[model samples]
Target: MICDRFYFESIDSLHVKINKLIESVAIIAIKMQNDLRQTSM
Candidate 1:
């Protein structure tokens, strides 16, 4: 039972980390897109 609980906790932490990483990537992508647009103009 303890092992099962630990496994779930680890999975939850991993999910949170993945969400943060996705958010960071999205922000970087938006910034890059804006830079490209400015350069084109």
Candidate 2:
């Protein structure tokens, strides 16, 4: 039972990390889009 609980905790931590990474990528993408638009103009 302890092992199963630990496994679920680990999975939860991984999910949090993935969410952070995705948010970072999204911010970068938005910045790039803005840069492209400014340059095009």
Candidate 3:
């Protein structure tokens, strides 16, 4: 029972970390796109 709980918690933490990474990547992409538009203009 203890082992199962620990395994579940680890999976939960990993999922949270992945979500944060994706969010940051999306923000960076938006910033890069804005920069490209500014340069073109």
Candidate 4:
């Protein structure tokens, strides 16, 4: 029982980290797009 709980906790933490990483990547992408538009204009 203890090992199973630990495994789940680790998975939960990993999921949170992945989510944050994706969020940052998305923000960076949006910034890059805006920069491109400004340069073209």
**Clash pairs for candidate 2:** none
Model 2 off-target regions past 4 Å? Answer: none
Tens digit of per-residue lDDT, candidate 1, span 3-33: 9999999999999999999999999999999
Off by over 4 Å in 1: none
**Can you give the TM-score per candidate against the true fold?**
0.98, 0.97, 0.96, 0.97
Report lDDT (Cα) of residue 5, candidate 4.
100
- Candidate 2 lDDT, 1-41, residue by residue in tens: 99999999999999999999999999999999999999999
| Model 4 agreement with the true structure over 1-41: per-residue lDDT tens digits | 99999999999999999999999999999999999999999
What C-alpha lDDT values do all the predictions have? 1.00, 1.00, 1.00, 1.00
**Residue 37, candidate 3: C-alpha displacement in angstroms:** 0.5
Candidate number of the best TM-score = 1
Displacement of residue 35 (Cα, Å) in model 2 is: 0.3
